[model samples]
Target: SAVISQKPSRDICQRGTSLTIQCQVDSQVTMMFWYRQQPGQSLTLIATANQGSEATYESGFVIDKFPISRPNLTFSTLTVSNMSPEDSSIYLCSVARTRGEGFSTEAFFGQGTRLTVV
Candidate 1:
């Protein structure tokens, strides 16, 4: 199993500020994903990080807003480039885990570090 740890469990930042979150895994993985969850809402995938290549961002997210870096298989970093009240959300780190045959894969969340931008 893969375990992930994140820092700054929660933070309250002023407007027009930025926060950088770090994600570390216990084991080497082919890919790592960054997600954001609004209060009482489903997770939204922000980007995918593959070692040795630039991170691939999903629609609606630009590299300038959420820059990602994957220097190795077990480590990655994401920086919320700009801050706004709308950016307030719970950020989560997840990795896909393989399951038994006929069963779908599952994603593991890192308890989610809540970020509040005022």
Candidate 2:
């Protein structure tokens, strides 16, 4: 299993401001995924990023709002643009790690960055 860490465990921001969170993994991974947990909801996929290529975002998310960057095998960053109170949520980082014979799709999530936009 790989260990993952996230920056800024929690933060409060004003509307129209932005924040960037960083993620780091102990081991090199082929793919890194981003997710969001709203105030009272389950996790939702934001995007998936691999080194040397652009990220693939989910239906509700767009590049202009949630920009992702994976510069290497073990690190990545996500920036939330033009924040608002509605944007407050727990942002998490995930990655696929090998588990059993079949490609293990097991995901490791970061502690999560809690953002409160006011």
Candidate 3:
């Protein structure tokens, strides 16, 4: 299993601003994923970042707004751009660790960053 450490656990930003969240894994990981969780809502996958490659953003997400950077196997960053009240949410970083047979893996998550855009 990997231990993920995320920074700026919570913050309140002004409208039209941006926040950059960083994630660091104790061990190397093949893939890293970023997610957003609105109040009383389930997790929404924002993007998947792989080391040495461009991150793939999910539908309703765009790089221009949610840019991601994975510089190496154990580090990645997610930036929420042009913030607004509607963007208030908790952002999380996660990585999956597979063991033994088929598609069986345990995912580890960081202590999410709660952003309140006003």
Candidate 4:
């Protein structure tokens, strides 16, 4: 199991400003994922970050709007660019680890960064 930590657990920002959220894992992971959970909505994957490669953004998410960096196996960051009121949401960091043979890996999530854009 991996323990994840996210910085700036909550914040209130004015519209048009950006916020950079950091994620740190206690153990090294091959793949790290970023997700967004809007108020009253289920989590939506934003991107996948692989060390030494450009992060892969999900549909409806563009690199310009949400840039991700996976500098190493245990650290990654996601920056929400050009913030808008619609961008207010909880951002989460996730990692999946193998459980056992014939069983699927379980995902571990950080507490999440709650952002509110005015």
Cα lDDT tens digits, model 1, 7-90, are: 778999998888998899888888899999988899999999899998999999999999988999888888887799999999
1-117: candidate 2 lDDT, tens digit per residue: 889999989999999998999999999998999999998899999999879999998999999999999999999999999998999999999988777889757889899999999
Model 3 residue 103 CA deviation in Å: 3.2
Alpha-carbon runs more than 4 Å astray in model 2: none
Query: What is the TM-score of candidate 2?
Result: 0.97
**Can you write out model 3's per-residue Cα lDDT over 4-100, one digit (the tens) per residue?**
9999899999999999999999999889999999999999999999899899989999999999999999999999999999999999999998888
In model 3, which runs have C-alpha deviations exceeding 4 angstroms?
none
Candidate 1, pairs of clashing residues: none
Q: Against the true structure, candidate 2 has what lDDT?
A: 0.94
| Residue 107 shift from truth in candidate 1, angstroms | 1.1
TM-scores of all candidate predictions against the true structure: 0.93, 0.97, 0.97, 0.97
Count of backbone collisions within predicted model 4: 0
Off by over 4 Å in 4: none
Clashes by residue pair, model 3? none
Model 4 lowest lDDT segment of ten: 96-105
> What are the clash counts of all predictions, listed in order?
0, 0, 0, 0
